[model samples]
Target chain A: MVKTVASVGLPVDEVLEIKKNRILPEGESDGKKKRISIVTGIHGDELEGQYVCFELIRRIEEHKELLKGIVDVYPAMNPLGIDSITRGIPAFDLDMNRLFPGNKDGDMTEFLASGMIADVDGSDVCIDIHASNIFLTEIPQIRINELHKEKLIPLAKELNVDFIWVHGANTVLESTFAHSLNSRNVPTLVVEMGVGMRITKEYCNQLVDGILHLMETMEIWAGETIEPRKPIISEDADDVTYLNAPTAGVFVPRVKHWEHLKKSDEIGWIIDPLHGKILEKILSPVDGILFTIREYPIVDHGSLIGRLLREEARKE
Target chain B: MEKKIIYEISSLYRDNFRVTGFEFGEGEKSVCIVGNLRGNEVQQIYTCSQLVQKFKVLEKEGKIRKGHKVLIIPSMNPYSMNSKERFWPTDKTDINRMFPGYDLGETTQRIAAGIFEVIKDYKYGMQFASFYMPGKFMPHVRMMQTGFENVEMAKEFGMPYVVLRKIRPYDTTTLNYNWQIWETNAFSIYTTSTTEIDKESAKEAIRGILRFLAKQQIIEYTTHEGYKSSVVTDSEMISVRTKSAGIFDSKVKAGEEIAKGQILAQIIDPLEGEVKENLISPVDGIVFFGHNDPLTYANTAVFKIISGGI
Candidate 1:
């Protein structure tokens, strides 16, 4: 069943609405059933989660007898952004993710965010999915803050992602959706995958499998689940190396993404299109696995080209 | 006044990003004024430029106190300003939100870190800030209620109002909030306009800053006494939101005295040119803020009025 989580009147007799799809075990009373929410599309340009939402619901409906708990799917949290293909809210030019735990008495955007938090407050678990911006493509990974490491790391490992990056606490995290929930003692995991404005089917499928496995662990699903792959967990900040463009040029990749490399390996070339000259040869500084690569070719000085996970850290 | 490049980042295609500081006098770091962290804050940078010009004359005349130093940075994000963008041109990130930033973080964070390192330890910090919404404000000094905030100090600015805002979670990352946390008496001054220059309010804001500096004994200058600033909390203000989305026709401007039930604005339909709604005031007060944009979306706050009493 579909329900409107929040609605606001727009000009010209129009209305802005956020809706969610709720699935419950067939013919069973929802009394005290464990609930897991799958949230996505906080950024309009991120469409990878849209496929996951569809696949999760499609599979759940296909086998109604195997479901024993409640599942909530919130797709397109920023519907306007999705409709217009903009990263932020269209008219407001505000990032939706930054307004988490919003004020009920605040403006339109804030009120909407508040409503979302209220609706998802009592879930047993939540998975907030996101995609990298248009500038880069990320391997399916879960990012956790170090403060929530004790509670989230074990849960994140069950998500079948390639990497679990535990970041140090930052002030900006207070206003994020996952942080808002986690601080409230609501277990939430943030999953980042693929690239902006496009969906990767394989990535989406991988996440859907992980979500099912998580549901089984929470006893929310009674269906068969696959054994998820062990993921590399990086807690130390120094375990990752960022590759930045040395100069402004078009980047041409010399190696495939996710390829393991030795030190001084050529990863890409920054070439000047007009002069047909190789301005800079981007090389790996350490032996590692390339997890994030620039999606868009245009690069400026200091633009991030890719991120490498050190092989030694992975082995540990 | 001595001009110095405080923080700079080399750009490959464009000029190196430089945050230039204009300094006056030569000893204790008494005050630091920042302007235009966002690209579209033209009025803010303009106000700081005027201050820079004033300080140069004051220094030449030996009006600046011997042991006090003042630094004024007119514009911080010139790259975005050059491209006519409000935030960082490449990443569209707001530098104002990345306070006391991390040096090894993203571009905006690094820029913020570099700027904050030099300006953090000043005795007083003032930021010419623009509102999130495109609007006009009745030039006021706003301080975050961070427990360390001294309301009496804010009143010294002598603006029409000294607003004490309760810090929201998002406010924690702002420059004003972070500066206060770092033991600096920080205040955000909002003028009448952002993208466009409102000379009258600009002059009023400048006078307020000058008055505060003189009162603090940071500069040996005399300026006319400004407003006897009324202190008010954020809860004392009432917001009027539009009920319809259309071409907005505001009936009044900021700083106007309004009566209860007064028609504040009209929402006119775009297609048929019909009046959709007339926004009426609920209380007799002064218009503290008025939406400056021509269009209005449904449920958008068009006006913020200060209630009848403090």
Candidate 2:
């Protein structure tokens, strides 16, 4: 069965509007069990998460016999953003991700966000899928709150990702979508992968599998036994290194993404295109994995070249 | 002599209030030229004042003859004009949105009604405007009603651009919108201004209004230069938005010719501090309006480039 959540303005006078597409279980006798909900495409430009949601829905539909608890999938929470092909809905210029637990009577985006929060209030768990913001390439990862360590950390491991980043409640504030859900005592996790404006099939597949693993663990799916995931985990408030360009020039990188590096190793070089002068050589500050790298290379003063998760440098 | 007055409401109360107007002639083709309902548009006031003063001089010199008692209300939002705001005191509702007036509505609605009541009947109406929206727009005449005569008058204005715009029928409070309800011919002349009006655009708008009045025979004036085009539509106005959110740095100017695929602007990453995306013109055209300021978010209209026509 399908259900429609009428937001502030009665869900846009259309029969097949996005908000109207809600999937309920086939023969669910009980509604007291905690339910896991998944959402993607809060930002229009981030398309990979939407693809992941589609893939998961198809897989779930194929094996309906395994379904038990209710799982709501919102593929595109921000329809206006998708229509305009923009990240933020143009009417109010507010980011939906940041407007969670929003004012229902405020501006347009805020109202929508608040309405979504209200709709998902009693859910057992929620997962928000997102892509990088049109700048950096990212490895598949899951973010959990440090405060909800016992609840989210176990689920993070079950996600079967390369990295598990435990984000402290204080560090991310209540501005993010994950924070809004977590604040309501909901076990929320933010799964991020792929670069902004681009997608990787492998990364999307990983995210889908991880979500399936979580579902089976909750006994929502009575399917075959799934393999547990071994993830490289880090504390929320761990030491991190910011790699910045020392000189103003065109940056050309030699080190590839996810490459294990040593201290003082050459990561990239900045060169003046006109005179062929090598202005700066980017070197790794600590021994760790290159977690992320800047894709676009026109560098100015104090531009971040890459971010290295310094595993060797421990806190004093 | 039915006299005109500027009620400097600043003296009457703490908040500012004033009435702007002009009156001349008496006859069959009565007209009123009101302008700049939005604030941050001082150019319309200047042009209307100049035109009314011209009519006043002709009437005083005894050279005036025939057609229309003209009323020109130059700048309605005197407080906004003074403070460089686009809307009313606190509501920030566009005065244009508050049409046909409301007795119990907001400040903007009340003012809109008062202004409408003053000039409901006129044979032909024209409203002068300058860009208060954060970009440079070309000098053009916009009208709602259909008919070759309205287009002809717009052409007669001799502006470089003319647009036969569809003023949404629901918006009946605007001067042009109201004039249409009263069965009067109306057009809006738009050019450039927000904090400051561009001089060349201002001159072209004034010249267009003069040419329009001349053809109406309200005052005998002549112009040898031909109009750039007969008219334009809302479809012709192509608005270009940014693809990414960041600090915007522009590379082109309004009215400058641009090639297809040429870089128009670049969005710099606030976190990384580099040019992340370079916005380019998808079609060959002339830049109509580009944001002069650098700080802008993604998907916001950075420029409006128009193509075709000489």
Candidate 3:
């Protein structure tokens, strides 16, 4: 079922609208089924989630009996931003994610945020999907906040991602949609994959499977659970060490995402573009996993170009 | 005797960013001054860069006291500054708001983490801060209301007003609040402008910072006596706002004392040539902040006055 949940525009002019795709069980059950929400395109530039949303709906369409509960998919939150290829809301230039649980009486952005929170409030679990920004390409990862680690880990591990990063409390803003929803007792998972403005077909399909597996874990769906392909993990954000450029120059990357690294291994190099001299050789500080590398060559002093996650042992 | 590369950041683009700081009297980390963290903060960058130039000469003259070191990072977020942007270029995030940051987080968070790793150990920190609003403020020293706040220490800088702010929930992530939490006496010095260089206010700011270092016995240089700052709470100030939106005409400037009934500004209708509203000073005190934007919005704060007896 599709419904125009929120809209804005004059009666005579073009009215902007947002539609929610609700997939319900095939037949009326004895009891109310649990609801799971899948959100994507909060950042209008991240296109990978849109494709995943499409695939999820397609699968549900094909096998209606496999779905035991309702699936609410907000395929694109900022349609105007997506239309313009901008990261911020088209008219206000505000980041919609930062204004979650917004005031209905406030400005247009806040009203929209408030409406969105209301739309997904009672879901048993919520997923905020995103693609990495323009400067970097990332391995598929599920990032869960540390405060909800124990409550979220089992489900996060079931997400079939390459890595799971549990962020400290301060890492994610309280105003963010994930935090707001999670704080309200709705378990939330943030999935980041591929790159901004473009959809990685491989990552999209992989994440769709993870989402399905999560639904199965919650007993909301009867489907084959997909195991993680690469399950390297970090206990929390503290387990990550950052290597910054000590000065400005062109950065030449020496490593790729998901690569294992030894202590003092050269991760990248900073070079003076005009003089063509080697200014600094950046190195990994610990024996860990290199999960991120700056894709852009130009860096300012103190810009973080690389990050390594200190590995943690898995619980049997 | 010369500049040193304190930190470097390599990016995907054609150029690299460097945080260049001048080092003097290498001993204990006595003080560290940070310049613009935002791109549009040209005045803050200019003030810190001038201090760097001055300190280079001071280091040569042996005026930096023994067993003390001073570091001045003139510019940190130059990528945004190069393009005159107000935030990080790629993500449009504010670096100042990500203080004591997560090393594994986004770009701004990582940048803040790198600097905090270095400067958190310093005895004192000074940032040439700009206001969130586009306006001119009376040169002052601002400190957060962390348990470590020292209004007396702030007065040493000799700015006109020493304002202490209660830590808001959102302020916990700012650099000033984090520095205090880390045991550094962090003070934010706001000059008159953000993008435009106010040379007079900039000179006063540089002098005030040096005066602070001198007061701490970190340096032996002689300087003029600065303001015996009136320590004010953030709540004491009254904001004078415009009732109508239009082209603004101000009758008073920043730092000028005003009476309760005096006219502060007039909002003129942009399309129709007529006075829409006349804003009056409601408090008998000095103008602590003045709106510099040419236009005014209805119900917008145009000036912040230090309301009290003269």
Candidate 4:
């Protein structure tokens, strides 16, 4: 059996010496086919993606003969986040994922990103895996630039996920790995599923299968023929309603992630832990899908509790 | 002993909602001590307050033989303390990071400026702080790139260790960097993390302060039996980072030494019933502070190993 991993970055010592970041790759395939790079663990605390990548790596290793092209995998881009179980590097308090393409001499993130990005360069496709923001539970989905619908829509379909959100390129700046890769003319798909610090096996399985499906479509791996998943492409993805807490209390969410709700549906209630009084009962403001819900209970006034995916009726 | 309540900054509620800045044992040498910049750092503020009360009684009896004017701001961030928060009430900003604070900025900066304004006349300054996390810390003095005078004075503080470091500015812009700009001798001292208070750390801090006083010839340095210290430079400190995010299974205790690559802890994936990584010691040294909570994130510091022999 061919060993799957290409390299593991040893921690760099400082002037005298200090152990720094770690990076793991999938393989150094001599095959000249178009390549795909699946990367995760930029924020160590957001581990759902890490599991997904591991599963893919295992499958690729077990079936190496089926792989037609190189699939470089960097399991963790930020070891600091993984070590601390935090979204940001604890010591410097820097967000590793936010430091895009990365500076060679900057902080730890810059140095790590530079090396990781180099390994990923020249790949035909890139998949930057991430968990949802800790504050919300996002449906497992692949995000692509809305403008790239002509080229990426079919590719998104091949992922076999629930949603293929063709988001605008202007959503966030080129400060993210996916954005940086996309800017470099590589077709990139940013995958987001589950929530930070917690793993849902169902979502992880979904992402693993989706990545396999994409590999199969690119002819990198030959597997079972997958039925293409039709996605609910939102035209106005930015018109999202954010429900905030009215008082400081423990938020008890009634709605689950990916649930559909009608207007006035009781979503959650904030209860005062000290007095045992129901502080506020949040109701759905519009007939929409429950896109997100806050998992951590401790909430204050103005804390974003949930978000609604507004539905726009199809034109005749 | 002139007893009068002086307001560091006028409170929004009332003028008397003031920080009781304590001035003790007046002389040629002056030292300013501040504590409880974060409201969650209750123990630190309480200790400073108790120290003030102890000195006040001793001064009343004409017992404190110090020729230095020691000023204590027991609770600098009163608003946060009142709300029982780590940051200010309006905006959650750490007050300690607000160095060389603005006189008229946000809540945290204003508090920093007001505190700086009161301590500006002092010859030497020491800031007291508690960590956000819980752990016992060795009494060490931290100074930025200011110079050796502060380090020399820190030696006089007679703490167990004198830690030299350069860190990015946060809390308020008026912190260590600001103190450096003023060309004043300063040190930031802490017992441990934010939550738990260690009695030994408190004792070390108080002892260090007393030692500094004695070294200044303001008081006599009395050596406590069996409480000797080992001095280590910044380079000697080793930080042990966790390899994975899981429930940390720490096999080694702090203050103990083990050979290089010895199993210190295991980051276990509870669901899979598998040990993700076996975190081993990178250096032969004593573990100063490790993760108090078993559950930790990846990239979190599991142990601070000091290499120099004690």
Per-prediction tally of clashes = 1, 3, 24, 32
* CAPRI docking class of candidate 2: incorrect
* Number of the top DockQ candidate: 1
Docking class of 4: incorrect
Please, what are the lDDT tens digits per residue for candidate 4 over residues B142-233? 77654433565566665666776643323225355566567667778766555555666676677677666656665444655323445565
| Model 3 lDDT tens row, A1-316 | 8877666541122455677888888875434679999998888888889899999999888888888988999988888889899887763546788777877654456667888888889899999998877666778898877888888888788788988887777633787899889989989889988888788899899988888988897888897767756666677556778777676678898877778888888888998877778989998888878777777777666666777776543321
lDDT of 1 by residue, A38-110 (tens): 9998899999999999999999999988888999999979999999998988878899988889877778888
lDDT of 1 by residue, B1-310 (tens): 8899989886546788889999999999999999899999999999999999889988988888889999999999899999999888887889988888877666787888899999999999999999879889999999999998989999888899999898777788789999999999999999999999988888888889989998998877677777788988888889998866888999999999999999999999877899889999999999999997888777788899998843
**Estimated TM-score for each candidate:** 0.93, 0.50, 0.70, 0.52
Ranking of all candidate structures by their lDDT, best first: 1, 3, 2, 4
Scored by TM-score, the top model is 1
Local accuracy of candidate 4 as per-residue lDDT tens digits, A1-316: 2222222222221111112111122354355666787778777778887778677878777876676666766676666568777676564445665567775543344555666666678888887888876756778777777666677777777776777666666522456777777777777788777888888888887777877788887877776645656666654655456677665667888877778888999999888766778878989988778767887776644556776777552110
Order of quality (TM-score): 1, 3, 4, 2
Candidate 2 lDDT by residue in tens digits, B146-175: 442367656777877777665332334455
C-alpha lDDT of residue A40 in model 2: 78
Better of 3 and 4 by lDDT: 3
